[model samples]
Target: MLKKLLFLFVLAVLCLTFIPQLTKPSSTLVTVFKLTENPAVIVKGAQGSALTVNISFGEKEVEELLGQLTKPYPLLFVDSDWASRFPHLAEEIKKRSVPVALLGVQGQSYETDLNLFAEQLSQFEKIFAARPLWFRTADEEFPSSLLQQLQKAEINALGSTVQWKEGKLPKASKGEIISVSYHSGGRPKISDVKRLMESRTYQSVEDLLFRPTVKTKKIPQ
Candidate 1:
């Protein structure tokens, strides 16, 4: 009787455990997407052109949307993967011949966000080789130890992040040929901008040829 009771108890426990897993539905893990805000913009000069300087998703629309207008607007583009992903849109942009400039953004004291942005950027990243603008940390809120590890890993084994900022970024080194996206805004003084590109050790060939300012050939009207 004792043996039978023990076996029944064990079987009952096994069934209880197995039944919940088998019958209960799987739970979904919730994930939230954090969107990065591009720089706020202020445009001056030609009111004629529809194109505005920015790093963004909808650039090719310039032609079909308002290319009909007599004034053809062009964008001052930044060199990054975000620009590369849309070959079709880029093709449209090519037709328009929009001005493209590399606008780098480096973090000042916001170390945590900088590193977090880099790692997160790679997952579905659309631009540049690695995260641009190597700041001290990606996430300012993250604990310091983790940040140290990330810094050591990238500096030692992994490659360096982009080290340029379009405007003012503090406490981070700037590199030659800094790459940025359209959304990166607030152009630095011509002299300061020129200095960063010149100071960096090396430049990507494209950047070396055309640093600071690059004029796009006008589209045939």
Candidate 2:
């Protein structure tokens, strides 16, 4: 009798714990979508031209990802000094026809110093058998001086986040080469903008290449 009573008490405690979750207010149960301050963007100089995308993954995942895609996507790879650990990543990127860039070469002192951008590019070329045409970062914030330095390095195209101040574009290098911005979400979901994706299905790469800056609306936290 004591064992059965103890079992009943434990069952009641379990029910109390789970019942609250099941009986949550309907308002709290609604699906809410949060709009990020910075939306993903793609920059293509011309309508019919290729757009660039970025990935921060190792060789095996990159290879498997590329194998599954039927269409051509211009991938942007950022190589760092520590990339020596993944010696085969460069070759994997080259075979996939992705563009390579070097990170930690700009303002972020926590990473590499600004001086190593060119050096890393050179190192990447030797290692990957392809040259990177642009200099960029995961967080696309470049001071004016760094912009000039990158331009001087012959990195005509720049990949960065699309930022605006007080309804106006920031006074960065305006007439320079192509600048690209992508969804800040490390793992971007194409389904979030399914309607736009479907409308531009025929031009998937070109459509997806443009930045997905959306209007900011208040959403539940």
Best by lDDT: 2
For model 1, the stretches where C-alpha displacement exceeds 4 angstroms are: 1-51, 59-72, 103-221
lDDT of each: 0.34, 0.43
- 105-220, model 1: which lDDT tens digit per residue? 23333243545434433532343323322221111122333334334433211112233445564233332223322232333343443444343333232232222222221111
User: Could you give me the TM-score of model 2 versus the true structure?
Assistant: 0.47
Q: Candidate 2, residues 1-221: lDDT per residue as tens digits?
A: 99999999999999999999888866412321222223322233223333334454445544454454434444454545435656665566667665455543324532335565566667766776655544555455454445546555544334432322112223333221222323223333333222222322223332433443332211112
**What are the root-mean-square deviations of the candidates from the true structure over C-alphas?**
18.5, 21.7
Clashing pairs in 2: 40-182, 40-183, 40-212, 41-181, 41-211, 42-209, 42-210, 42-211
Which candidate number has the best TM-score? 2
Which 10 successive residues of model 2 have the least lDDT summed?
A: 28-37
lDDT of 2: 0.43
Clashes of 1: 25
Report backbone clashes per prediction.
Answer: 25, 8
